[model samples]
Target: MTLEILTADTLAPVRHGFFTRAGGASSGVFSGLNCGTGSSDQTEIVEINRARVADAMGVDASHLIGVHQIHSADAVHVTGPVTTKPKADGLVTRTPGLALSVLTADCQPVLLADAQSGVIGAAHAGWKGAQAGIVEATVDAMVALGAIRSQIHAVIGPTISQRAYEVGPEFFEEFMDEGPENARFFAGGDGDRMHFDLPGYGLSRLRAAGIASAEWTRHCTYFDPHRFFSYRRSVHEKAPDYGRLIATIVL
Candidate 1:
């Protein structure tokens, strides 16, 4: 199978993609484009997967940049291929010839770019990172790299949707603790369980950060087994590990 890449028109003329688990060398649980080096998948296979993604973005394998992704609001600025991936959740680059990438299973893989300013960014935004302001931080990082927040267009790739993201009252309360208005992002689930609208929250944050435009592709990772890799879905299936989907953007 050929690689399946999802793109958004908002980030016009930028070579970017939210890669699906379609074409890759890995097999079994960590099958199909599992570019996550942090996974238990073989290092060689992961490199091959990442190299495929780098090629798709029109860059050499080493130019595809990633981070340690501590699920924080931190963003790293890059000028070239990083020898060691930094401990950050977001990456921004003003330099051309570099592709910013992030690995995700169910988290929001956000790609941001200012075509006019020649800057691009990629962020890993799980609920913790999102709530802690990863989206806003990414925009800020892009701005620091000469990208106008108003000129930056952000697109959130595949993520777990509300219907599949059941949460506990504690989780709901935590978001509510951030703000009562956050209650709007949740729907009643079974008993004290609530469904959180992660993508909606991501859009809200991106828009709130004064980006030119923001939107989610609306593809639910948990719901689509073939096209996506879902951490929650893996847990439910009692699988030992799950694959990660790679999203990348190049200047």
Candidate 2:
């Protein structure tokens, strides 16, 4: 099977992709392009999958870098090969030949670039990270690398959509407590349940951060098992674990 790499025209001319679970060496719950080293998938197989992504991005596996993803707003600046994944949710770089990557199952994998400034970024934004301002943090990191906020373009890729993201009243209240205006991002669900729009909220955050443009690919991970890996879907099915999708951007 050929690797399925989803690219956004908006990030064009720059090497980047939202890699799907199409062609990979893993099996069981970690089948197809499971690049997550944190997963229970075989370490060798995960490395192979990540190598495929690196090749697609025209870089060596060493240059395909990622963070530890603590679901915080922390973003780090990188200039070279990372010997260890830093304890952060976002990565930004102005150095050429280094690919900034993020791993996701249901959370948003956001790729950002200011081509004119030769700066790029990738972020893993789960609900907590987004609410904590991971996207803004990433933008700030990129700016530190000489990127203009007005020249940056961001694309959110393959996340769980609202129709599949049912949450309880407490979850809804969490966002509301952040700001009552956040209520607009939630739709009424069954009784006290609500459907939170993760991608919508991400877009709003990116736009509010004064980025040049931002958009979601609109591919719902939870709704598409064959092409994506969804943590929520795995939990609903009582699966022990789930594979992670990899999104990358290189300058």
Candidate 3:
């Protein structure tokens, strides 16, 4: 099968993509394009998937860099291939031939770029990381790499949409405690449950960080099993594990 990679015009002229689970070697629960090294999917199979992503990005497999996503606001700047993945949720680089990538299965995979400055970034923005300010942290890291705050364009990749993201009262309260305005991101669900608009929240954070342009692909992971991998869906189905989709950007 051919790989399905999604791109945005806002990040045009720079190489980037939000890859779908179309072409891969894994089977069963992890059927397509499982690029996560941390997953229980066969290590060799995962490597093969990642290598495919690198090939699509026009970079060597070793240069397809990523961090050890701890769901924190931390971001790191890398000049070249990294031997050791840092414990961060975001990555930025100004180096040519290096692809910044992130793995996601429902959580937002955000690709950012300032093509004119030759800088690019990729972030794993789960709700926790986003609430902790991962978006701003990524922009700051890019700025450290000579990218202008007002020149960066960010695009949130496939993630679970509001209609599929039901949360408990505690989850709603957590965001409300952050700020009452956060209530706007949640809508009434069943009784005490609420639906959170993760992509909407991501766009808000990107704009608030002063990015020149920000948009979501508007692809809902949970709703599109054939094209996406959704952690929430996997859990609901009682699957033991789920494949992770990859998103990448290179300068």
Candidate 4:
């Protein structure tokens, strides 16, 4: 199958994509474009997948850079590919000929660019990273690279949606502790379970960070088995491991 890449108009001019689980060499549980080097999937196969992504972004495989993604708010500025990945959830670069990428299963894969300033960034924003301010941190990193706060456009790619994101009272309380207004991002689920609108919360964070425009691709990873890889869905199915989707942006 050909690669299925989802794009947002808000981030136009820059080559960016939210790649689906298609056009890859892996099989069984980690099938389809599992670009995560950290996965149990064969390292060679993962490298192949990442090379495909790098090609799509018009860069050499070595020019495609990613972080360790510790689910923190940390963002790093990069000028080129590194021999070792940094411990960060976000990456920003103003340099040309470099691609910034992130791996996600159900987490938000956020791509941001200020084409006018020649700045681009990619972020891995699971709930922990999002709540900790990954989006804001990414925008700030871009700004430090010469991107204007009001010129940056951000897009949250495929992720688990609210209807599929059932959470415990502790999760709900944790967000509430951040702010009572966060209640707006949740809906009542079965009994004490609450459904969290992760994409909605992500957009809220982007706008709050003063991004000129932000949008979600509206593709739910948990709901689309053929096109996406979902960590939560894999757990529910009792699968041993799940593929990580790759999202990339290049300058």
lDDT of every model, 2 decimals: 0.93, 0.94, 0.94, 0.93
Q: Please list the residue runs of candidate 1 whose C-alpha ends up more than 4 Å from where it truly belongs after superposition.
A: none
lDDT of 2 by residue, 1-251 (tens): 99999999888788999999999989999989999999999999999999998998899999999999899999999989978789999999988899999999999999999998889999999999999999999999999989999999999999999999999989988898999999899998888889999999999999999999999999999989999999999999999999999999998
Cα lDDT over the full model 4 = 0.93
Q: How many residue pairs clash in each candidate?
A: 0, 0, 0, 0
Model 1, 1-251: lDDT tens digits are: 79999999999899899999999989999888898888899999989988888888889999988999999999989998888789999999988898899999999999999999999999999999999999899899889888987899999999999999999989988998999999999999888888999999999999999889999999999999988999999999999998999999987
lDDT per residue for candidate 4 within 1-251, as digits (tens), equals 77889999888889989999899989899888898788899999998988888888889999989999899999999988799999999999988998898999999999999999999999999999999999999999999888999999999999999999999999999999999999999999889999999999999999998879999989999999999999999999999999999999997
Q: Report the lDDT tens digits of candidate 3 across residue range 149-207.
A: 99999999999999999999999889989999998999998888899999999999999
Ranking by lDDT: 2, 3, 4, 1
**Model 4 stretches with alpha carbons more than 4 Å out:** none
Q: What TM-score fits each model?
A: 0.99, 0.99, 0.99, 0.99
Where model 3 places Cα greater than 4 Å from the true spot, the runs are: none
lDDT of 4 at 139: 95
Error of 4 at 98 (Å): 0.7
TM-score of 4: 0.99
Model 1 vs. true fold: TM:
0.99
